[model samples]
Target: MPRGFWKGLLKVLAFFAVIGGIAIAVLRVWFVDVVTVRHNGMAPTMILGDRVLVWRDARLERDDIALCRHPQDDPARWVIGRVAVMPGGEIAAERGQLRLGRDRVTHDVRGQVRFTDGETRHTFTMSWGTEEFDDYEEHLFFDRADRPFALRAMTRINGLYLLGDNRAHLGEDSRTFGPVQASGCRGEVFMRLTAAEGGLPDEIPHGALDILD
Candidate 1:
């Protein structure tokens, strides 16, 4: 190989390497975070093993899907839930319905969801709880005896109410602990990198996706 040709090839490779490194740094510092859904907490909207692209700096909003630290568990472990109430708001659950101030968050039953995996069939009624049915659970209530005896008013100080879409599964969420601090939040889930498939039912009652007013 000619000496000049070798030098030019080396320069080109270095240029491309620098560009790749800058792109990665930008993504890590200010762009996005890729996370995987480890559980069925935000089911239908985001299922187990679904990979998601989260905007690390987007402003949180009511009904927005987000990745945040569990209120009472390991801070390093991230939990996915919807922002039911934002900072400076009060949240409460009454009769299986969420109430924000004077307005009661309402949902419309869209349809039924059913799917089979192997020899097992799973079915449940579907509805939009906050804005989309995908991010919130259909109204499922615990028995009066099993319900929390003292339902405290969750006041968002510098945090927000992070609740799971599958309320019936109630394990890690504001309902189990309290409101989630904003500082513990990682980012807002803007896109699903994984295809919506598998044992999950695709049919929704109303429009496939609709935001509740």
Candidate 2:
């Protein structure tokens, strides 16, 4: 082959490689992207309108905060919560502590949670308790029935159940519906960028640090 022809071919290959790389990067960011809090779910730990970077590809474990789509609702929208259970395991709330099957979990108290559901969003207020569930339970309390609701026998193989730190009063998680499936999970959250003001009261609002790998 001619020397000039070889050089030109190499340049063309390099140009295409660069273009392909850029395209891949953009697609990854779009699918495995970040979400900012428009409302309050993490509360004192995370304020309203905080920016959180999520990892759609990260391996999710118990207690890892994540961004996911609604398992029972429309998958178009995304929400945030922490992993409390694993496949074959169960999560329950007792004395404010989260129970994983029969195992007990302890967690740090961050803030309160206020949840509203349905068409108009029914409001419920819960405080930040001394203890919180650090794991997943199969039996969850149901409002309509006195008995606990048994979760799917098999945990969503692809995803984790996300929940807000403010369990009792927050609408930031699965307690309102059910656990979040893995397919619905977009990614793990790395940072929490909070708004300057307005959402929170007269409090020094600080966002969460990056948790993405």
Q: Could you say which candidate leads in lDDT?
A: 1
lDDT of 2 at 35: 66
Error of 2 at 172 (Å): 3.1
Candidate 1: tens digits of C-alpha lDDT, residues 131-155: 3333344432212223332345766
Worst lDDT run of 10 residues, candidate 1, spans: 204-213
TM-score of candidate 1 on Cα atoms, chains taken together: 0.66
**Which candidate leads in TM-score?**
1
Error of 2 at 12 (Å): 32
- Identify the runs in model 1 with alpha carbons over 4 angstroms from their true place: 1-30, 115-152, 155-158, 204-213
TM-score: model 2 vs. ground truth:
0.58
TM, every model = 0.66, 0.58
Candidate 2 residue-pair clash tally? 28
lDDT tens readout by residue for model 2, 14-123: 99999988975885667546466655555434545566666666777776777778776776877777676655566666654455666665544344444343223445
